[model samples]
Target: MAPANSSAAAQRVIGFIRRTQAPRQSPPPACPPVKKYKSLTEIMAKARYAVVERDDYSDVLCDQCGSGERPDELLLCDKCDKGFHMKCVRPIVVRVPIGSWLCPKCSGEKRVRSFSQKKIIDFFQIQKCADLKNKCSSTQDAKKRKRRTSLILHKKRRRLLPFIPADNPSRRLKQMGSLASALTALHMEFSDDLTYSPEMAPRSANHADFENGGMQVLSREDIETLEHCRAMGRRGECSPLMVVYDSCEGYTVEADGPIKDMTFIAEYTGDVDYIKNRENDDCDSLMTLLLATDPAKSLVICPDKRGNIARFINGINNHTQEGRKKQNCKCVRYNVNGECRVFLVATRDISKGERLYYDYNGYEHEYPTHHFV
Candidate 1:
């Protein structure tokens, strides 16, 4: 009985020892719980609801094509707050533009077009000047007084009208066609009516020379003299006037466009010496005589050192009928603000390109060209 009890106790002790010493295997992990997922319809409903609630996107997207996957493929417009993809834009850009980007509508692409060259014609193709043709076939008596040899044509006429239709019409047309093609190649437009009007011509080209364009400032002595003359009920010579030239009228003086009626043109700055008769005296023949002031006392003004542009005025030889019609300007001695001043006042509205002229002494038989020289 003692052996049987001891054997049973030993068996229990050995089992307990084996159970404590041996490595125990962990129970297999319980099967993972089945994950519950929403249906496709429910997912789509949620996505649509989110889009309806917030119409704007959180990430930067293209306004043009609604593409946002590629950040580098977008171009922002400078004119408008809109983004566009490079592929969706008209005239598609291969790469990003460096400067500000303007959409097709913002940039004036269709408004400008290349000018056509088929509408232009030669300058001389219009008509031949009647005045030149008439002068060519004038009487010998008319040619004797005012010789046609003295008529000096300007060089600008050659540049303006290089072709004469009478000489070679076919060559002239060919040259005009060549000029049109050349202008077209250079991206230039040539319209009809090649003549330059007053409004069309540049304001700077109206003056004789840029150096003698504006009005000169009067000296302090001249100002004092002006004031003194004003007190004596004479005219003053303080005005903004300029000297301009034209092909027809030769050298003439004109005031600003706005100035009219009783404007001071220039001052005769010579010494007002009293001569009994300027013809009898040993004075130069270029002196202007004031005869209306005093009969016996001939007030002669000879501008040797101190002279203005008024000295360059030429004598109008109106012996021919054409000369009478060509006169455009006139000189007058006026009491300008109390100073005695000789001004070249416009008899009519002086156009911008029109030349200034006056009858020197009103004796139009022969012109004294030597005095002006």
Candidate 2:
């Protein structure tokens, strides 16, 4: 027998106990889901697709230092198909065969071939020159270059053949080869016909005394002596023109050659060495100049950048008592020595192998190679 209000309170306690007894479930997690990654090879595989569109490459790895770095990061060799950084290889032009660019550890191997017992460098083989000859061809490209070169050579010969001091006609060539000496000898045959006497021979074989081969430059006092030589003949001295060995002629050549006196009717062509030969003893007495009767041609002359050739031509042979213009080649006789050697208003841009010659001089280096004799 319980009171009604106490009965209601007992029922409330029972309900609270039931609620507390129920199992507690765990709260849901707050973090996001985990992710998975592809392998390194797979990643690199994707990169290749992007890189394939780029240009050519050598090996995938560096060849020089054996580094594993990619080829694009290194300097690549075109011929060998290898890659190296600029620093990893020896300093040389990457191109060209004679010069070699070697890797740091190329097994201590000699990289370049030997020429004349020396490592080939800059692709030049000087000793080979005597044995070497121009690789001539009948190809259009080769012929065009050859013709241009020949014309230029002919022009230089015309401009410079007369100023050689009467010593050895190409004494310099005797040391070089038989070919050049032949050219010198051929050029001098015209001398006898040209009116110069031939006392300046035998000295051609001597090189040790080559510098002292002829007359010293005429000093101021020498001018008085030259004047005396001219006056020795009497009254007015031999004509002012006779004091010098010059002759002038005019003709039109390629405007691309050297420029010179346009008014005269005779000219000279190249190789200072040739002119030096004429000035030398052997041919000096025997040589002569040739000219054209045609008015369409004129004389021309060119000088070295130093202008020494021009100066020597212009210098007074005090004994002869003549200065430059007075010694003009136009003053000489025609066809007596051969073809005219002068040109006027021609151009001067010579080709790479083309010899840069002048009428009154011969090459320091002789013909054939046009290299230092």
Candidate 3:
């Protein structure tokens, strides 16, 4: 009887403990039911109509050239309302379309395609096409008359040529040093040629009037060579130049091979920004791109972030005779297709293993180069 009573008391204790303990948590509430659509087409249709807001085109400018002149010639995109010149559109729109026309951005079509897909402007192709046509005409003329042979060996004019970059990618990156990282951080990409931002677009005194800008126009041969160099640069090829570290001068560009006079070393390339904006900035590699008559319209190329081998080339102390003697390249600004572009040309024949130096202040002597090495 005593053993039965003890067993019964233990059972009662266990029952009380189980009752006092907290109840098990209920399963998580069922997720709300997902709305069902008849088909993907129905969902897409709803999405398309969801965006009801329309862009304003009251004072539209050409999206390509960013000019408001000749408003009659501008074609407005039906969806985004962005304006573009008829001639600027690819497949050249001669006349306004009968119905709604969409800009490249609104239509989801790429404005600029890869080089492999399109031949780009006829800038380089013009030379080759002309040469072929000339050859055909010369052959026909020869058939009609006897050809005269001249024994005089004429000297071929040496034009600016593109730089052949180092074959090793690691070596190229190593030579670039902190510039590569700086470019990535600034949201700027390495470019071999000048790039125009919205603010730096040609305006006022630097407008697209090529003939009236008092800018130097390049000859046909020179233009062809320049275009070729630009294409090579876009493809990541640079002049046979290397960057080396110096204790005093920091990074300096050295010729990997003998560079002839009038050779195109590299273009001063970077984000073209207004001078007023960068006045307080501490960038050391700024190059004067355009000096508009209006002070507000002046622009400068900041190459500390985005630039080619040209950025590494140190400046010479023009005040010193020795500094002037070390200079082998000259920076010249030219107007290409109504755009201001800076090119570094060999002022004299540059020897292999020689460092390149140019005047920082140009002819104005505005920049102090006394401390330059």
Please report the candidate that would top TM-score against the real structure. 3
Tens digit of lDDT per residue, candidate 3, span 1-373?
9999999999999999997895978889999998898977567545534421334434668887788777667786666556787766553453578867877667776433223212322211312334676546645543432211111113354455444456774444443433343233334556665666666543433442332246676666567667756654444344677665453355577887678777778778887788878887767778887777676777788876567667778889889899889989988887777777788999888888899999888875656678776
TM-score of each: 0.28, 0.15, 0.52
TM-score: model 2 vs. ground truth: 0.15
Write the residue-wise lDDT of candidate 1 on 1-373 in tens digits: 9999999999999999999999989989999997554766455545544543563544656776677756667665655545667766554454578866776666754422222333323321233335754335433323432332133123221110010011243433443443334333223343211122343232222221221222233344334433432221111112323333333333344432333332233344444444443444532324443333333433445443234444444445445445656555565443333233454544554443344455555532222533331
Candidate with the larger lDDT of 1 and 3: 3
Q: In order, how many clashes per candidate?
A: 10, 78, 2
Error of 2 at 170 (Å): 17
Q: What is the full ranking by TM-score, best candidate first? A: 3, 1, 2
lDDT per residue as tens, model 2, 19-107 = 79989878888788654337664554455544435665433555545774544445434334355654344332223334344343443
In order, what is each prediction's RMSD in angstroms?
28.3, 25.7, 18.6
Clashing pairs in 3: 163-238, 163-239
Evaluated against the true structure, the overall lDDT of model 2 is 0.28
Error of 1 at 54 (Å): 99
Using lDDT, give the best candidate's number: 3
